[model samples]
Target: SGGLHGVGASVVNALSEFFLARSWRDGYEWTQEFSRGKPKSGLKKGKPTRTHGTMITFRPDPDVFSKTHFSYKTILAVSESKAFLNKGLKITVENKRDGEKPVTFRYNNGIQDYISRIVQGTTLVNQEPFYFEKEDDFKIECVVHWTIATDTEMHSYANSINTSDGGTHELAMKAGLTKAVRTYAERRNLIPKNIKSISPEDVYEGLYGIISVLVKNPQFQGQTKEKLNNPEINSPIDTAVKNACEAYLLANPTMADAVVKRVLLAAEARLASRAAKETVTRKLSSLKMNLPGKLADCSSNKVEDSELFIVEGDSAGGSAKMARDRKTQAVLALRGKILNVEQVASLEKIQTNNEIKNLLATLGCGVDQHFDLSKLRYGRVILMTDADVDGAHISVLLLTFIYRYMPGLISHGHIFLAMPPLYKIAAGKETFYAMDEMEKEKILAKLNGRKFDVGRFKGLGEMSPDILKETTMSPKTRTLMKVQVVDHKATGKVFERLMGKDPKARFVFIKERAEFAELDI
Candidate 1:
């Protein structure tokens, strides 16, 4: 179903070797079959049904793809998103391959429901979202709400197609919201006269918004059609969103004031952080640039071709460096666990920590407002820790650091957690490795009748250089669990509940996820 323009049906038909389609309409039912996009049979009559609809079944050609596996999650995401964008449309997605659990999605409330679903965990300034629509040369509609969450999330669509690289419409929406909120704050005398004017980043810090537009003859910037190039619709969209948001705020003073306070607080924090960064910058012993002395830097300079392994301890670091591909793989050894970034109060304090400083500098991206993903030195930033509870804690601490300050690294699929073998089994000259208890059991069963010895790896340092290279350091053979953001808001909430200062929240979170936990001696 992923195709360009109206080619969805034809594209699916062309790629599928065996295709079947049925249509029930006009007091008659018709069916057809195709083999490789060619008609195997013409219109065949079928028994009449109560409803009129079309159903299609397809199996993509095996030759077209090296692997034929499909992602149920991807299918479900498309169905759910479509159901939300098209009000009153019912979409039922089923995974027939895996016990076929069907989920029905019908969003009569449209983007309002989507907004509510996205902000379920966050504290909202307004319980009910503000929705607006306008029709003229272009049909524009949007829904917006502010959350207690720090990051601003914006989703944009043109003709129901997601525009990940937002263009003029998104810019217009931001400008409108910022201007309206700033004006309201000023009129209410919420800001002290000494404070500088509010910034767009401040007003948008906690914004959760979606902008959907129906356009005619859309001009796109690239092959992906990620951004809209048409400039004519910007003014109209800006006017519509601004007027609607302004009107809603005037009608609800409490909500408006609360929103203003949230933005003002964000602005204050930004200023404080910037001032602290300046101080920290001055405090550095030297401005001379160099990789951390402990880091075994890779020869490759291209970001896409390089990987950095943040190993747990000096022993593991030495092993990883010896096993690593010197051409592209770099290793940095941390003494112990990184500082809990959530508990750290100031940017200067974070900068002062040697290990944290090395990480920031090695990435070639500063934390907070100074972070530039384009200047990042590594394509993959992997956490190569031991397979233990402490290792897990270290990973969480590192994740917290990235999520809090340089979130772009995670969202862009650059962060990963390395998977090292947990056990090594040798049967005479034949040696086998296992990643988990299940894998170990399988390997033991495979060498059932033969004499074998089992060796459990307590840490990466325990593995010989050759074994480490084969199991964890080699890009071709290593198993790396990518750290990605599937649901930004949900992920943020989980991070807050697990790593923030709220012990009660953390306990509740642990309890919820521990339902399937089993105690091990």
Candidate 2:
């Protein structure tokens, strides 16, 4: 139960036909070769090098594995996670056979760098990051920050391996944060004198932080290193963070004041939002309005059999409403773009928006932490937008909303993106749909130079209802890709780069990936 590097390399070596591990330690380099968990050669001298680290190369034995190759994304994700957790440690990846240039990643700011990357563009309570490190019998370092994004992003590690299923360290950190914030608020009279309580969940909204612990004996709960079972690590971290945060607050009175004010404002908004939701719930309970005016709901009472198509624009919505299976598919037409929930607090304001209000009323499920999955009317939430850049942006905005407010949607596998064809190729009525440029080329190659007519789908509005149903709306024929947050940190980095206010990051991202873009002309 070592760290990720040790565990991953061990597993790879155990399953490999031939494994070569080179280590540089104590001012010398050494190598070890293994086969099927048995060493082929003892420790041998390697070439002298200035660097001090280990390099493991292993080829999985075909006989041992159903698939011998490792996923590039998976490996890259692991490396990225390491870089994130370790901060200043330099990590690089290269494919030797392909002669690909090595990609180097290093972050001096640690989790603050992560927070800045994740909550880009969104307004923030404070520009400067809060950082603390404490070492005792149990060593721990924590970084905490908040962004304008109305979601919490946290990652915890024990001895450098990610604990996806957090352990005592995470629990302690949460407890510490809750206590520190509550005590500060009460001392400052931020909360009402009558109310004596505040929950951890309440304090964490719009917060992003990372906690890393190093212990000599780490008790992992599973083979995946998802949880830590070390009981001793909790109190040390709790005390350390409590002391550190208190000192930080006192030292940086201005920053602390701003944070407390923000939290107090959020608390007030939360109360108002709760009241609004109760009103909505009471109205629904009375059966005063069974459905929203804009929604063309499905007939099915069973949630599993029902699907909701969130269409952008009135024209696409009309087409979807007509093309939809009236018994199983519901359509909610969005009049215009909704507020970017990423940068907003109190989703109750979102509920005031006509489109969002209609959606909430139709679905009968609340938003944010108040959202009840059981109350949802649809099993599938499909984002059906035009096949253009604007449509893509709208879809992303919607995704950001869902990802922030109703993470359970993605976690439970209910979220999807509808893939409508970009080009409709027809050769004398022999029609074929090309989803992208690669598909268009493949279809052309299949035709063997035969003259064919091609029609580019400008948007969902341009397609007839029947064509929309066949190519994009119908469950039996449509291509729906389920949205997943496999690597939360990596996804956070991507969002920060693309949506963050930093002009330099967005420019670099666009320029680097420009070659992959396909021109519509």
The candidate maximizing TM-score is 1
Predicted candidate 1, C-alpha RMSD: 5.5
lDDT of each: 0.83, 0.78
Candidate 1's residue-wise lDDT over 1-521, tens digit each?
22466467877888899999999997778899998789999999978667788889899986663236676766787688777787888988777787876899999988878888887767898877888888888888899999888777898888887776789889998888888888888888898665689999998898999988889988767655668888998887877788888998899998888888889889888887888777756754254266788899999978899999998888999899999999999999998989888877797688788889888878887678777788788999999998766778899999999988999898667999998888889899988788767777877876768998888888999888999999888978888988866566567788888888999999999899797553323
Winning model by lDDT: 1
The Cα error of candidate 2 at residue 117, in Å, is: 6.3
RMSD to the true structure for each prediction, in A, is 5.5, 8.1
Q: After superposition, how far is residue 121 of candidate 2 from its true place, in Å?
A: 8.9
TM-score of 2: 0.60
Superposition error at 253 for model 1 (Å): 6.7
